[model samples]
Target: MNLETFLLKDKIQEIENGFKIKNGWLLICESTYDEIESKGIYCALIKNKYLEKYSSSHSWPINYGYEGKSNVYGDNSYQTYDNEEVEPFLFRKSFNIKDGIKKYIDVGEEFILFYRLFEEVADKQNRVYYFVNDYGELDEVIVVEPNKVKIKLKYLKEYITMRDMHFFISFEYMILRKTIDKDWNLEFIDKDFSNENYFYNHLIRNDMGTYQSWILGNYFIKPNVSKRSYLDFDNFHCEEFIIGIDENGEIILKNPKYESKGNFTFTYFKKEVLNKYYNNPIEYEIDSFSVSNKYFRLKIDNNLENIIPVLLTDLLILPENEQLHWKQYNIPITEDLKLSSTYYKTMILGNWYESPESIDLYFKHLYNDFNKKWYQKFGWNLYKPLAKEDEFNFKALHLITENNIKSFCEQTLTIVKLTIDRINEKEIVKGIELEPNTKGISKFQKFLESKNMDIPDLFEFLRHLQSLRSGLIAHTFSNSNKECKKALEYFNFNERNLIDIQKEIFKKSIRTFSTLETHLL
Candidate 1:
């Protein structure tokens, strides 16, 4: 039996058997083309879509305005964006479907298009076909049929079958008003489906009680990452579903909020269908996020690196729930570092600036969203405890050893160096020469002294941190050395408090951000 009859019989049995027949439309997903033709159609559309975009790297020879005998001509002097000329008819003429398929001829001109799926991979599937187009240039047009389809329907099972078939062939889906003819055929009620609430209601199964919650609490959070970032949502469900035709001449729903991974006919609606479609968008909270993998860490923001190369170590965090599955070079899988609770604690209550306006002042003209990553990173990484392996082995791996501490110090000192460089570049402080053949802090201090400016206490704290690092870990010394005792006394830290000392340094580091941000500008 046809899909229409199969669905109609079930509906009739329900109504006749003393069941309440609800007034609703059955939106079915149906493919217009068979599998054999679909591959060709998909290829043609893909090629037409990206031909000019990849014109430079293509091996096709330039045959600009080449007229080889009859009907074989190329585009004259057409230069691509890369300034490379592309010849028309890169694809051979035998691939044209106009002669083989009659329906393709009805649509204006035939354009040969092809795309290699997974071209970079060893096993690539090539799809190519004649794309029908009346318009000179193809935009997102794939299928060459009536895309705005309106069907009369009122059955559930047929819809499920067609929906599953969408994995093999693309099709558009829409439910019109409940209408049927005398011969058990669904009748067309309207030209297009416009009831957004109705469509969302059925898909989301937002029954009478929870329907209002779905409508009122529907909000989308777009992350401040690149378009390719997984955290970035392409068609956040709040937006209307973008309907477009696939390579098959059928309507394919582009971006549905929910999808079925296994493309099979669902046996039960209430149990199978409802569970697959049900999702409470309101429960998606962005405020707090749990790491999706074993561990998560921060990376230095590369925002101003190309221009100034500032060493802002605590300036970016991995996206919430972003998984870090790969093992570090030396760290074994069994002893992988756990994300410290201190990371979360400081991130929640980080005091980076006196006010939000201070942030705006420093990050002026920078992307507004760029600061969000920095805010998360600075808060998380600031209070991270740094120590020798014997003292504290895991949490602060980047700053654990004497050499690593020296490297961290050097990296951290870039903030001061960056500030001075910016100051010199903008002529904020004129005629200042840092002390030669000295440590970074001494050089910075001499530069400040030459400018007749009192050194900030933040620098003094950094100097003490350096002293502690150099004395206890960086320099080779006997356990009872007098210099180690002197360094510990000067920094006001002893062997007992070595592990926790980083917390104080981090607090001091955060206090200086506003000052560095001011001078860097």
Candidate 2:
């Protein structure tokens, strides 16, 4: 028997014999892809065919081309100035499908196209294939000729015999026509399907009630099949029943919607079939990618880094077909980033930013996010915390200020000294001038010249600090109250300056370290 005939008259009749909801298309949830790990589409059936637009709407805060800012919508005088209200479907129109698949799945064309299944339209293509809601439970796909379908289904069941098989029979597709009032809203007037069946009275006759559209969505299992097969429809048979070669491939079924699903069969009526049949997927595969090992890797957003000389930097998420390996890296793969295999190998084999401009922008954004926090963290390490009272705290002049001004100045001086050393192995220990009678200002000047860092103001501040410590601070035991007050006053203003310069020193040092690791692109 034709699947549609068996489904409409016998199968549906058997299922709907005494089922609770008597009015509409009914597909029940029999199983899932993975009960815990898998998240598939399981939605309500019984649609309201006439009412247009879903009650819910989505918002994407990007205004114009800029993210996190608003643009054109405010000028409209209407007090209802909500961005979504002004442009309910703006996000979908603003971006392409690929981008829509990313950043904002619930907005744009993906939203309009994918989400219509959620609303009770019961018709994704405005046609009812199977008159049902598909619960996205089909993980594996098997493609074969129409006569070979029984063997194909059996072959499919073999893959499930050992592993758990999740069968999902969705009943939400049961069509329900509601009684409505002046506003055309559902009045909930209960008309029993127990008496008049939409399947016999309307759908089978090709006279769709009220809506004037075919129900039960459909798709072509063999999208790439030749046109010759379509032209030779007169010789078609029950093999056509399993899969049809149309008798008059193009004469009847005026609905372009009907033309899409071949002549008579309604199995592939919905877009659900296309995702499976278009490529003709076989065994269910986990649609994700992960790094190969336990090594923690950076997942940066730089696509340009792919061409650089850097090694072991960032793993850009790639698509499945684009992947080379998926051996369980520490990175958790999500639908947002399927994580490509080539990108995975590239991720494990890191690269650095070669473009100076890109490096600057990337580092600046990194600094703003967390590198500045690290600078603050290092500043804490450079100073000694002094508690004046139970709840009062103050940072001392330097790492070990109580020892002497010489110790204090030396601590800060090491930052620049160590930085230069880290920047180049040849420069290590070369900056400290150990000449005859080299002391005080002469020594400081020689040191600054040898290091030749971009941070001059920082060294100047360090010099002034050294002077204060050598003169007034070194004699802490013999200092008068007036001198102590003077020292405190100097520290109050200069301490902040010291911290700011340290931040710059840290920024430069970080750049230098990254430079050591990278070859400029």
Poorly placed runs, candidate 2 (over 4 Å) = 1-352, 355-417, 420-444, 447-458, 461-502, 508-521
lDDT of 1 by residue, 407-444 (tens): 34443333322222222221222355544465556555
TM-score for each of the candidates: 0.22, 0.18
Give the lDDT of residue 274 in candidate 2: 18
Q: For candidate 1, report its TM-score.
A: 0.22
Residue 320's lDDT in candidate 1: 22
lDDT of 2: 0.27
Q: RMSDs, each prediction?
A: 25.6, 26.1
Taking the candidates one at a time, how many backbone clashes does each contain? Answer: 6, 44
Worst 10 residues of 1 by lDDT: 212-221
* Top-scoring candidate (TM-score): 1
